[model samples]
Structure formats: C-alpha cells, structure tokens
Target: MRGNRVNPNKPSLYLPCETRNREFEAKLLLACHAAERGWRGVVGAKKAIDQRIARLPRGLYISKSITRRNRFILDIGKRLGHIVTAWDEEGLVFASPEIYRTTKVGATTLTIPEKLFAWGEANATAWRNHPAFNGTPISITGNPRADLLRPELRDYFADEARSLRRHHGDFILINTNFSLVNHFLPGKSLYRQMLQAKKQPISQYGSINGLALHKVKLFQHFIEMAQAVAQRFPWHKLIIRPHPSENLDTWRGIMAGHSNVAIIYSGNVAAWLLATRALIHNGCTTGVESFLLERPAIAYQPVVSEDYDSQLPNTLSLRVSDLNTLYMHIDNLLQGNTSGQETLLKKCHAHACQHIASFDGKSACERILDSLEPTKSLLLDRKKPPLVDQIIGWTAAESRRLFKRTQLVRRTTTDSTGYQQHIFPAVSQSQVETYLQRFSTLLNRFHDLQVDDLGDCIFALSKQ
Candidate 1:
C-alpha cells in the first residue's frame, strides 16, 4: 500500500461493505504476479493488500468471521514483514488486491469458464511487474480447474456421454443448482452461510434459518420457469438438479406435483448432459464445456452482475423470468430454425477462447496441473486489513484486540475469560517508526528509494 498512487478527478467510492471490498480487491492487483519468488512475492503483495482490505468486513462471511482469520492475517503478515495500512485516498478505478494462493484449489470446472483463467493472466502479469515477483518461481498456471480436461481424463467421461445418449433418446439436459447462481451471490458471504449450515446442527441461509428469503425467491422463480417450460413442451422431459451441497428434498417435495417435471440425482448431472441434445444453464461456465461436447447450450441470466468482464467463446445468455421465452426458443428449435446459429455461436466460441480448452477440454487440466508445480512466484499485493479492525475500527475493544494480534507485540492476559490484555513490543514499534522516519529522510535526501538495479544499496548502506 506504500507504493499505491492516488488518482485525480476520480469520485471516491465508499460502497456497501461487500461492494467496497470488491473494489478494493480489484485494486492493487498489479503486485500479485511473481514468476520466481512466488510465496515471498505473494506475502509482500498481501501485506500491501491487507493495508487496504483491513478496512472492510462488508463481504466477510459471518460464520467464518471469527477473530482467528484476522489474527491469521496479522500473524502471517507480521512474520513476513508485510505492510498493514490503508490508503490516505481511495480511487474510483478498482484497485485489486493480490489474492493469497492457499492450499485450497478449485476442484470444479467452474474456475475455467468463469474467467478465472484470464484472472491468472492478469495476476501473473502483476507478479512480474511487482518488485517482489522478481526471481520468483511462481507463474500463473492458467486454469487449475482444467485439470479434469486432460487427455488421460478425456476418455473418463466419453463412455458416460455415449451411454447417456444411447438411453436418453435425444434429450435436453440442464445442470441446475444454487451454485449456478454463484455469480450474482457473494461467494465470500453466502457460500459461507451454506457451509456453516452444513457444519452446524442448524440449517440456515445468509443470516436466516431454513432457506434464506433470497434462496427461496430463487427457487420460486426457477420452479415457475421450469413448470412453464414443461407445460409448453409436453413431450420433453424437464429435469432439474440442485447443487450437491443442497438437500433439495424440500424443493423436490414441492416439485412432486408436476408430472412432466423431474429432479436429477447428484451423480447424474454430467451424464445427463452428455446424453442430451442440448444444455441449458444460467451463467454457468459448463456451457463452454457442453459446447465442446458438441451439444449446443443455453445460458440463462435472469439477473446480471459485475463479474462478467471475463467471457467465453460460444456463450450466449437468454434472460427470461417465465416459460413464454423458453417456449419461444423451444418453438424455434422444433421448426429447424437455428437462425444466427453458425456465425455468432461458433465464431464467438473460437474468438473468446484462445486457449486450446476453447475447442478441446483437455487443455484445461494440463494447464492447471502444470501451474501447481510448487515453483516460487512473487505475486501482486492483495493486502486486505484485518477484518475485525474493519468492522469496529479503532474502538477500545477492537483496538485492544488488534494490538494483541500483532506478532511482534507482547501481551499480558490480565482478564483471561473477561478481556485479554496486550503489551506492545517497543522494539518492533520503535524499529518500524525509526525505519520509516529514516526511509523518508533518505528519500528526501536522494529524492527516491532506488539503486541502479536490485542493489546499488551496498554503497548507500555503507555510507549511512
């Protein structure tokens, strides 16, 4: 965050916590890419990121909102000598923070078509440009989710596709689920609610128990659309599958009334798609893979969000609230009217996806695995502030908490159960202040902190 620059003539944005978090996240992304010193660069980047992200709990999921996470960031950043501060001025253009690559990997194919691959490109470049990424072994792996698409794995699903087509008698398949709405919903918050529900004895959705109002509304809209589509195409089977994490029995109990309408078992979503003549989805990247399978697909966007900057080839969205629109598309299909089919569809697919996975799914897995090679990479700074500090700021309790969380700071637990106490590390505090003060004086003396290249510092240090 020390190196961050302020832009003139830009309206400062103090959005809702979640939206502001997104904007901060988008800023400071330039430092995340390091080709060689991956972890080190990443740490340096996050230290800077933390300085900014420390401002918001807006998007932090409540269940995961334990003090431990903030402590974790503080401990890690402190140990790594990462900076923790906020900007004196916020900018209009989104300043992205560099994301820390944890051991967690995106196992689903969703990461690829969702423009995560392109995010890799941008992040990798950030690392390279970062003073931190220099000599780092880390580089972007493209899309880690593509690992399932390699040649060795290609045949794994081929037989399933063949078998499904043989039995289904030319069906139209859709992979539907609440996860399908991941785009519009905040992943950091809503997903945690779902996860928390699964973890705890209770079942809740986004601060509410038993199907959050938003999810209920989502279900209602889908049901109306599905029933309408079923009524129009009496001959076609209407199959719906909720996410694996969901116990759709509740939704199924409601759907039991529709004779033409049906729900799919968890394991069968992919198989059903392979057997189907067409695929229908909403903002799901599976549409790209479905097209590669040579099954034409439909993208349904009942709502749009800001996450669409990265798009794919051969993907088109149809926004509809009811069956009337679906009926029209079905009617067109029945009439052999695949209008604008060739040019817009095929060309867009080719144009949008430059990677081999665009035409062949195999490239995804290969690129992803190759990227996880344990090489060092210096990534851009995604410094986000400690979460609690963002929530409470410099309040007495929060300040005491933040004060104790610092690694270099010593603490004395006076209250134990009541309120833990802290004692600051004079050495660390004085050292930082002294270092900054000297750095500023030196910068004034020399006009900047630069050596000829990596180190013209020996002479400078010796001179001092």
Candidate 2:
C-alpha cells in the first residue's frame, strides 16, 4: 500500500476486467478515452489488479462489480489510498431488482465504492431504493459495454466480424447464458456458490432453486433448438456460443454427431452478432446487444416464468414459444423478410430507452469520463497509505492469494488455469496496440495514446 508521492502530472485510472470477452474491449475503450484526457489508464485482468494493488500507484480504481469478494479487493485499494468506484456488470439484466440486490450486491460492498455508475435510470433507481445505500453518488452514465453496440463504434469489430463471416457464412448464432446450472468447472454451481458466499439468505433457497430450474429448462430448450435448427437447415451453419462460464465439453459431447453445428466460446460476442444472420437466445445480454446493433434477435422460450425470466432482453426480442414458430421466424429473418421486425424494434427501442442510456447521444465512455472529472484533482492530491497499514494490507493480500492458490491446487474438477483461460485467455501487448490503433482509425481519436505492457495480461494506456 505504501507508495511514492503522487505524480500529479498525469492521474491514473485502474480499470480491472474479470471476463475478457464480455468486458475487455469496453474497458479498453474507456482506458483509451481516459488517456486522451491526459490520464494514465491501467487496464488488465482482475487477477493482475489483485496481485499488484499493494505495489501499484494509488489512483481511482473502477471496479466491474461490488460483490463481497470484490469488496475485499476494494478494501485493499481503499487502504492503499486509491479512490474506489464500481458498476455491477450483472446489474443491467436480471430476473428482478429484488433478486439482483440479494444475489449480486451486498450492503458492505455498497459501502466501499465512493461512487457507483448505473447502466441507466432503472439501475440507478434500484440502487437508490436499496436499504444499504449510504447516499453515495450514483451516476446514470450507462455502461461502456453498451457503447460498443452504438453505430459509431461498431467498426471496432469490423475485422473480426469479417473473419467470422468468411469462416462461418450465414450462421445462426445461439447464445446461452446458463452458467448457473452448467459451469465450466466440474461440480461447480453458481447458485450454491452464491449461497455459500452469503450473497443470499437461506430463505431465498426456494427462489434461487426455482431460478436454477428455470435456467435448466431453458438450457435444454436451447439444445433442442440447436438440434432442430441443424436438422431443419442442413445447409446453414448453427453455431452455439455458450456462456464463458459454461462447460464446453458438455456442449461438444451433446453436439458430437452434428456436422453442421459448432460450439465456439471465443472472442467478443459483438463480432459474432455482427457476422450472424440472426441471433437466437432466451434472455441473454447479447440479445439486447443484437437489437441495438439492428440485427435480428429471436428469443426462443419453451418455458417461461414471470418470476424467473429476465424481462428486458426477452421483451426486446421477437419471442416464440415453440420450435415451429422459431423455425419460421429464423427462416423469415434469414431470407431478409423482416415483416414484423421494424414495429417490434420500434417498440423495443422505446422499451430499451428506459433501461439503457447512450443509444443516441455521446458514448458511455465519454459520459463516464465526464462523471469522473470532479474526482481527478482529489485523486492527484491523494496521499499514500501509512507504513503500518501498508504492511497489514500487503500481508492480508498475500495470505488470501496463498489460500486461493491452495484451493485451486486441491480442486479435482478442472485444470488450475482452464477456467481462467476459458473466461479470459492470455492477452498480448500486440493485441492491445492493434485494438488501440483500430479505435484511432474508427473514431479518429486516441492517436496519442501509448501502451505499456505491465505483465500478467495487463497494460497501461497513456499519452506518449
């Protein structure tokens, strides 16, 4: 925690990303935006942040979530005199506000972040209504993730999207978000893990179990849908992209004999959505992204529950409850007959406007940077942690690191790094530089931003 005096010349922003495919590009865009404003943006894998927090320069740390585990990390950052702020990655799409509050946010975690960024007015209102809210400023600046779907930044994925189209021509992308029931690590259940972490009460067992059952039903339905699509349209490719946390082997095993189907879990989903003919999902975040991208999105819901289904994505999509209707919608969408799509998208746009910001105005990256302006001077003048506190914080971080390593070693379910790679495969310095260059070309900005490799899949973006 102990560090040298503040540089003052250029403030730093530490943006840690947990899942690479989901968060990396958006955070990188934010980092590039920060650098353009004369701030050094340190962006990297979340593990890198945890390992280097004690030694890194104190700055404003923008966390991806405020779960209890994240609260511990934020505690360390706070001890090190780093300003803390966060917006839950899972906050935008959920079954209900109450369930989200119970399962995703903690009262103690809420106390750690100095400020909270909300995806939209809905999330801001939800957080404000939470009993644990301590009057912290909540900015309804939207999420940078949403910024990627905006037309202005869609070219960021042009190369990847082109490659996808070249390789998997006219594919129907099926995105599944069922990690709660089917996790990458064997025997791992996100539901049980949440309960074990005290994120939910024992009283929530029934509700949580019901949600898990609902997802299982949806998962099975997706498999059936995939099979049906493969058989129905043998000429077209049926690509199944499971949630990053889901077991890939299970999918491969299930679709073993299907020659037309492929299970892929790589790259940012934006590219896939761009390349696909149509996106079929139940209630995934990507459905909303597809709609925003003006792509055809179909929500195949064989079973639905008011209490368990996510509202926004489903409502935003063209939903069909049966396989025949799903096939018909797919056929119509693929053949470019968007007969009912425009009206649906118009209504969905109005609906999405209530839940998402940054659809028509300045990008969320700019909005977030604007919100952070008032904190820059404070961050520049921030003092270092006292030696005693530094020692304690360092010791605690080391102990926790060792405990996690020991647990990883003891696990019999998967390889130590398998799940990590599945979520965020190692990123290279060249990849960061390439994307930064792409951003510069696409937006005619960020030309002065320089990248420095900080090891452990981390990089620093700053003005050269």
Candidate 3:
C-alpha cells in the first residue's frame, strides 16, 4: 500500500474537497502551508512578518510585488479567507478561487511610483509565478471606505452636518492634502508651537520616504493660512479635519488662540465631501475624492509640493503662495466663482479616477453581494489542497536566501574605500544615531512602546 498504491475505497487526490468547489483557494491553503514551513529563522523575524501581515488594514494589498510579501501575503489570504483575493496582473499565485466581477472590494490608491513597484515586482520571482497569479489583470473592485458617499452611508455624513448646525449657523470643511512635509507633521502640535526642526534620516542610504521627520514648518504655514482665512472672512463655523493619522493636540494648540475652529476625525473621505458645499485642500487626494462627488475644491500652496499639479480633481488652486493671492482665491470660491475651477477639476478627476477605481462609492458593498454565485465562487473551484510543507519551506528559504543575498551584495560593494579624507556631510550618521538614542530613551518611558509599528516609533519619540 505504501509503494505508490491507492485503496479503491478512498483514493489519494491532489486537491482538497474545498478547492474543487471553491475554485483556486485550496491551492492557496497549500501554498500558505508551504510558506509557513519555509519561513524558518530566528523567532523574532518570523513573528514580526507574521504579525505585520495580520495587522495590515483590510482592503487591497497594493504592492507591485504583493506576492513578494510571501508568507505575509499568504497569511492575510488565509485569515481573511474567502473574503478577499490576492490581486495582481495575472491570475496566478493567490488568485481568488471564486471569480466574480460583481463582488465589492475596497481599494486605496495602489500607486507606488512605477520605479519602486517594478523593483519590488522583479525581486520576488517565486511569488510572482504562482498559479493563482496567472490572471494578468483582475478587478479587485472599489474601496469599501467610499461607501460613505452612498445614500445609505450618508447618514454618517448627515450626523456630522447636524453637529455642525448646532455649533455655528454657517460652517466650512477644509480637507487636508499630501504636502510631503505636511503629511509628516502633527497638525495639532505644530499649530500650538511654532518650531524649526530637522530630523536625521533613519538610514543614510535609501530613506527618501517612509515617514520620518516632523512637518512643523509646513503646519505652521497652514495654521497661518487658516487664521488668515478666518480673519479675512466672516465665516462662523470651521471644522478642520486633519488627516486621520495626525496628532489633534497639535492642531488644537494652533487654534488655541481662536475659539472658532472645530475638529472632526473621520474614517470616511467621501462622506465628509458630501456634507460640505465646497472642499478645501492643498492638493490632497481628498481633492480627487471631492471632485468625484462634484464638490468645489480650493488647492493652495501651488508651488511648494506636487499635490496641486497631478491629474487629481481640484477646482481652482491659488496657484501662487502669496497670502493675499490665497485670500482672493478663497474669496472667489466662497462667492461661487467655482465653475472656472470645477470644469478643469472634473476633467482631472475623471481622467485620474477612471483608470484606478472604475466604480462609484458603493463599490465595496456591491462587490460583497457576489459571494453566492457558483461560477464565480472565490477560489472554491480549485478543488485542491496546496502543498503546505512546500510553501512554508519556500517562505523560510526565501527569507534566508534574501538575507544571504543581501549579505553577499553588501560584501561586494564598497563606498569609496580609498578616499578616507572628505568634509563631513551636513547630515551625519553620528547625528542620527544620537537622535535615535535620544528617541529610544524617550520610547522607553511608554508602556506601549514595545510594538514596532510606525505609531510605536512616534510613541517612542514622545518620551524624548
């Protein structure tokens, strides 16, 4: 019986019962098993990757090499099993076992600069080639978060409005933007305290962007701009919803002098746009969201960053940095000179949006309805159990393989070994180390600073 023999009563099969019925997921389960086996390493590394994959927010995983996340990706797939599919250009590895065009999914802007995405895609070849990834381009559908724009979800928006009605006879909602500097700063804190600061990069080499450094100056600029708006206009109510990931105290401190400003932290962008008549942003993605809803938007600080210039929907930007110009632009928008900007913004909105999110705000809700169809059951039809041991082994192997490859690459490369005498760069390694040391001491004071998430790093900063 052991020598390639099968008992007629129960035959050995490649796939599990679920895969044939579900489509491709059985294969995924096996792949996940393989990955778990493959991720052999010091307990810390495996644990970290495992936790990160599980902790990442629900919605599409938007990495070009999403598969490269390897075990991490598989873990998410397995945990959220049947609820989500691994999306990529091809229907190969981690492809949804059930294929339904109607199932709603949530999506965030998956853009990662073509250069970065391409590099990641090339680096993880094994994950890229998995059978589930064979579909060249699959529609993962629209963002579930956008459901806030739907009439059903608009109640949340209405409540926000009612809160506004009680506070002031008239109000304005100014959505924030993605000025790289502003994105990094805590709005509540910067407004409270005016400070000039610079943070040493985390890595001397490869630290273009990953959320380090405080955006104090930019927030100061924004606070000043907002104050100018209130002083210039007789507006009574103003709700300043900084980005969700901001420190509210910073914004509150800035507005401390004036009692007129209110703060609202919302998880939904579309709902906020609908509740307001006009949108104000310094070229944030919310500008695009606002445009999709046909709301008038004001984009300021036209030259300082890339926000105002992209194909995102934006009514009229001040197009200049002068305070007077900004006031005039705000005045014109409040007075309804919105068409000039609206037409252009609509074009940008339409162009930018059509390619990425083809569905409206109800995309996620609508997508969820398709779970019942047999032909498109997500991954159910695969009728196969994946080779769990192989996948786990592969994951472990890849991790070690990558570490070794990195070590090998580092050994081969030298950064000007012969030129030992040169002027010290303005931003020095020692400076950063000193800064990090101070931060570590700061982080040690907090009980929760133990976690390694981005917020944990910030918590660690507060102690300093």
Candidate 4:
C-alpha cells in the first residue's frame, strides 16, 4: 500500500534526532541544505519518527545510530520501502575501536543501512574493518554537528553565548558525560538496559561492569573537582552541566550547600563553551568542540584508566591529573595566560585531523547532501511495501504508541516524563524558524527555506 503522499516530484529526507540540544540545530542546518537542493527535509524527535514512520511518505531515512536497539526502526523503514542510511553520533570519540564496535555498532544492524556516513578517516576505517561490513560504501563526510563548530558558523551561537556570559559571569563550565552509570531513570542505566535488551551477551557483562566502574570513579572525581573549584573561586560561578540522560537531582544533592555552584543542563553546549572562561571535562565530546571553538579545554583525569578513557577528546585537551593542577590551569586561563594552549593545540591538531574533518572549504552538511544526490533517483523509484505488510507495520506502530502512553503514566518520579522532557523538550515551529533565521543571518543562505509544522515535535523544511 502507498503511505501518506507528499509532493511526489520532490524527494523527501527524514532525519530523526534523539537529543534536542545536541542534534536539533545541526539537523536543522542539514535540512536547510536539503531544501536548497529542492528536497523536502523532515526533522523530528526520535519518538515522533518512531510513532509515525509507517504513516509517513516513503523517503530516505537517516538514522542517528545503527545499534541493535535500532533494528526495529531500520526493519520497519525498509519494509515500508524507505532507503536507510546511518552515522553514529557517539562513534568519533570512543575508547577503542574494538570496544566501540562491540557496544555501539550492532553486527546485524550494520547490514541494514544501504549507506553509512563517517565522521573521519578513523571512523571509516573502524566501520570498514567490522566483520559485518558488506561493502555498504561508507562516506567520510564529517558530521553536520561538527559543521556547527566551523569558524563560519560560530556566529550562529554568538547571541546565546553573550546572554550566557551576562547571566553567569566568567563561569567554569564542567561538562559530564556519565549517563551510563548515572542515568536519570531509576533502574535504567544505559549499560544495564543494553544488557537487558540482549544488545550484548552475558559474557560481555564483565567488560561492561568494568567500564561502569571506571565511569563511576570519574563521576566521583568530577563532583570533588566541582566542590574544590567552588571553594577555590567563590567569586566566580561553577556551572555543572550534566549529561542529558544523567540525574540532575543527584548532582544537585552532591553539590548542595555550595552557593557558587549551579547544576544547569539547558541549551546547546557550544554556547556554554563559548561563554565560559574554560571548559572542564574528562572524555566528553564537548572537549573536542571546545578545542574547535578555540576555547581552553581542561581534561580533569584524577582517576585514569587507559582502557576505559576516550582518547581523542582527552588528547585534544590540556590534561590535568590532580585538583591542584586543575586549579593552576584554571587560574592561568582566567588570567588570560594561554602560553601553552597554542603548543598543545598544535600537537593535538595532527591527531584531530585523523579523527575529524572540520570542513575548511565546503561544509559537512553540503558534502552529506551532495553524497545523497546521486542515489536520490534510485531511492525515489523503489516500490512500496505490500498492502498486508504495510497493514502489519501500521498495527505495530499503533500498539507501540499505546504502550508508550501506558508506560508514561506508570513511570514514577525519577522515571517520569520529566526526564524525557529534560533531554528533548517540546519544540515549536517558531523555534525552528528562529534557528533558520539565525542560519540565514550567519551564512546569508537558507533565506528561501520555510518551516512546516508536521506535529509530534516534527518540522518539515522546504524552499518557499
């Protein structure tokens, strides 16, 4: 059966975003690029996409990740006659290729996506060498997320950074990425949940447990570092931005009694990195972003584990192994003494070049759209699924929607909708338009793009 019909003459591109602050603006920029190329770009929350996938018009679906957990969505999209492609958002800054492939890339799910996009040479090499890889043709186009960090696009976040600096003056931004152990959901640690879902076998439990233990140690060190910073610099604010999936209450509880410390998990992190005097993180993706933005990135590694620590981000940062050294580095950075930053960045630049393509000339978004252009006709000409299969898919989607509603109602305090909203708040068409306007002002492009509300926090962008 035919799915919901759009403008058949205009091919559609579906982009599902799991995290708003991280993926929304980047995907929106990508959508604008797609619209410029005369294709309809539908960008939405992942939940919305999952609920409406079967009903939406057949299109090229770009999945955020290809983990085993995403198999259902991949299968459904293929069964509904949509061309599938994917790039892992968490693949670039990983512990090791072996561990990353084991935990993030699903052996079976890797075969589903017809094409794959890589962040850089390292990512492409890892995926190409995977046992499940079947000559799927991996494109080494850097992520659109990295596109936002390019100098040309830095102006897009200028206003937000200014406002942040005004509200929180000269703050030390501490970005934590420990949701695997400190998840907002009560019994739902990401590692544990993956195990429960059989994403990895029982034999892998020891490795998972060890990684969790390492993260827990790092989590505790971060808390201590925050406390120390608060004590050391009572005049300046210490902002602790937890991971979206982390428990904000836990951070608040530990950081209580510190008047200078604020537990904030709002807005895009690029703004925070721009506004802060220096960014403090261990192995977060934000560390690399800060380096890209020419900000002082401090990797506080009080408790280090070579096996568990992500190399790229930390390597790109100014590593400090103790609280005293962290304080000294912060002091120097605050005093505008960047004597060693240039030297460190120079060394890290050669390493980062292997892992990330910063789009010195053409943007990553443009490159990705260009890559998709050659396959557009083939994707558009594919036949629709059989009527019976479409019916089955629709029924399954409806059942999932009903089950989700029920689960939402049954969730307790820690596992409630509050956590989901924290990660992906309700988005409006106005917000999308505002971002589009910002993009237009920055690049003098996307002026012809128009936003259409597609409901369920989804928006479609196309040329007016």
Candidate with top lDDT is: 4
Worst 10 residues of 2 by lDDT: 1-10
Worst 10-residue stretch by lDDT in candidate 1? 454-463
TM-score of 2: 0.93
Residue-level lDDT of model 1, residues 1-464, one tens digit each, is: 12222222111111111111112111211111111112111111222233333332212110101122344443333223222211101110111222111111211211111112222343334334433322434323333223323333344345666876575555555555453233222332353355445654242112332223344345456656666666666676666655443344555776677776666643323345556655566544555445444445665545433332113422443334345566676566545555534444565655434433323443432343244322112112224456664344434334444554563233222212111111111112232223333334432431232111111010001001
Candidate 4 lDDT tens digits, 1-464: 11233465678899999899999999988999998898888998987787788778888999999898888778778877788899999978888787788889888899999999988899998898888889998888889998898898898889999999999988888999988867887676766455446564458433765676677778777888888899999999999998888888988999898999999998889999889998899999998898888778999999888888998889888999998899899999888887677887777787877787643667788889889998776666778789887777677777766766666655544324765677789998778888888888888888767778878899888877
Residues 1-464, model 2: lDDT tens digits? 11122234788899898899999989999999998887888889887677788788778899898877677888878877888899989888999887787778887999889899988888888888878899999988889899888888898888899999999998988898888777887677666456446564368444876676677678777788788888998999999999888888888998888899999999999999989988899889998898888877898889999998998889988989998898899899789887566777777676787788777787888899999998886777877779887777788778767766665554434335666666778998888888888878888988766788878898888877
**Residue pairs clashing, model 4:** none
65, model 4: CA deviation in Å?
A: 0.7
Which 10-residue span in candidate 3 carries the lowest summed lDDT?
455-464
Cα-lDDT of candidate 4: 0.84
lDDT of 3 at 386: 54
Ranking by lDDT: 4, 2, 3, 1
TM-score of each: 0.43, 0.93, 0.48, 0.93
The global Cα lDDT (0 to 1) of model 3 is 0.37
